[model samples]
Target: MSMADLVRAGAPELPEGYFYRVRSTNIRSLKVEIREQRRFRSRLVADTWVFERPDESAEESIVKACDRAFKGWQEADAVRASYLAVTAYLGDHDPKGGR
Candidate 1:
């Protein structure tokens, strides 16, 4: 299905600078990657199942992956606040596009 269709069909909403990719590992396996957009490229932020066996449906996995990614982003911000403050003190005000 198209991305829009997937989004309409209960997929989680992506925040700005965030997106996902769905891929089939084989006939019986699928994978979803949630990423954060950076200046030159995107970085893999989190996933739903990781190395675990695929049990959930593709749509379900997509939604779960999005949720995990979004939460990961928030947690990163919280965990990195001190680091960011130090960088800002050093004059690097813009980091990760303020994502």
Candidate 2:
């Protein structure tokens, strides 16, 4: 199975208006999506972490990664900042917008 599928299966339950947007080609990469919100300030939980574990299913690895992201975002200020940066970068990339 593709890593993307694993991520999709392993994704967490985000707060209302929040979601994780996975890259089409890069399965390991993803960013947070906050919908229809004028403002938000909490640190976004996302980072490039090696999720694979020995003897574990792809789904399990991804679930562990998501867990770490969630935990770090909740417990660390730096994680939140990193999350914002990722979201900002993603927000800047609008395929529908005329370039």
Best by TM-score: 1
Computed on alpha carbons, the lDDT of every model, listed in order, comes to 0.67, 0.53
Once superposed on the true structure, which residue ranges of model 2 sit more than 4 Å away at CA? 1-12, 22-45, 77-99
> What CA RMSD would you report for each candidate?
9.1, 14.7
The sequence of per-residue lDDT tens digits that candidate 2 reaches over residues 1-99 is: 433454577755556644444332366544332222236544344543544567997566556666666666556667667888888655465678857
Which candidate tops lDDT?
1
Which pairs of residues have clashing backbones in candidate 2? 43-80
Q: Which lDDT value does model 1 have at 77?
A: 76
Which 10 residues in a row give candidate 2 its minimum summed lDDT? Answer: 29-38
